[model samples]
Target: MTSFAPDSIVLNRKLPLWYQVSQSLRASILGRSPQDSLRLPTEEQLAGHYGVSVLTMRQALKELEDEGLITRHRRRGTFIEPSAQRGAPVRLLGSVDAIVAQQSGMTTELLDYGTVAVPSGLAGHFPQHAEVATYHRLRSEEKTGEPTNHARNYVRPDLAERIDPADLIRWPMTKVLRDVVGASISRITDTVEARLADPETARLLQVPLLSPILHYTGVTYDEEGQALDVAVIHYRGDRFSFTVTLDAH
Candidate 1:
């Protein structure tokens, strides 16, 4: 059996043991090089390394198998799937920086852009302007070519004027606001909900109509508490996951 460092994965009693183990295993599998073993250590070895029960370790392995990252065999052993794709689920931990950090190396495609009267539903997000610049965008994994999210962004008129369409295609909206428009972002408020995809969203994301999706609405604000931009992203439910961290204070 291949040997593994016992201290490689540190467990947080506060979180689910199986989840922690699975995440660590996933990272290891995804980070492996060609020279690394294609097969994983036995469940008993992994359980001993992580100081978890065999049942908990099996649960962790099951999670990877469900993600198509690994396959288990009764006669042989557990091996990483050859067709596994890059960019495992997007993990969000209650911060804009964290979100941006996770999106590194992804490719962006700007589908459409135009200026129009701000929708009444988004009026509160841009109270000072009746009209705003809008963009329709889709981002996907560069390696696997799998669609991750479909997003529509509305920018304040002033900031939007300073932004270049090229920049929107090259960088994240928040990055464009900060680097191109020179807007100071003080905070970001994200509200997430579960909803079924509409026809347009289903078409763009390549999913069946009415398929469950994660609806994310994020409002970016300046130090003065004025909203500068609003982003609505429809994430494929199976392709993305959010990890939320909370403190009791």
Candidate 2:
């Protein structure tokens, strides 16, 4: 019996064999209780379940491990790792879990809110616009209350009207895009670079003027490739960092 969506390895034979097995295990791992989250099916049982050899199952486990989703114990079983916060030296490239992480609650300081032109050379990026709702937001780390990211977001007016003012201040932009604006995200693109924090940015971010900062500019697009929102984030270099893992494909 299949345990999760996209886990029907028997029916989806054309797909990569090991990957389906991993999704099935991923479902299992994520669903388990905290006490049982540490326990995993033996590699032999998992291999037999999908009619694959232990080597094939091991390969799938390696994929999960490299993603920071699991850890293996010598002479013991593998265990699930806890989730990490999304705000940071934000992942220019996102994983499935990282996308989910973006929706968690975080406090925000609303800087500016109003309508604005779509801007020159960006007409193709918007779904439709001469004017759209624009938001300037500053966020802090959830637990420590330290500054996290300073972001600006622009959404098409028709879609932007659905967003509640309160929700925009509290919810992550990713959630507002999906839940309030009802956009089906096709893909996201962003570039990370280093730059000096200007006076206003330094004051809002609580960093010294002219301090070096890590900056990111990102655009989210719909399935049709029309832009949903364009965002730029500035992260303090001292307080934030990204952990990048290299995976063998």
Against the true structure, what is every candidate's RMSD?
A: 7.3, 6.9
Q: What is the lDDT of residue 158 in candidate 2?
A: 75
Best by lDDT: 1
TM-score of each predicted structure versus truth: 0.67, 0.62
Kindly give the stretch of ten consecutive residues in candidate 1 with the minimal lDDT sum. 1-10
Q: Which parts of model 1 are misplaced by more than 4 Å? A: 1-87
- lDDT (Cα) of model 2: 0.67
Which digits, one per residue and each the tens of the lDDT, describe model 2 over residues 1-249?
222222223424544566656655554454343334355567887787778889989988997787666788989887667552323233332432244344243568888888988876466777457886788888885556767668888877877878776776766677778866777887787777899999878988899999988887778888888877887788888866654433454
| Model 1: per-residue Cα lDDT at residue 111 | 95
Candidate 2 backbone collisions, by pair: none
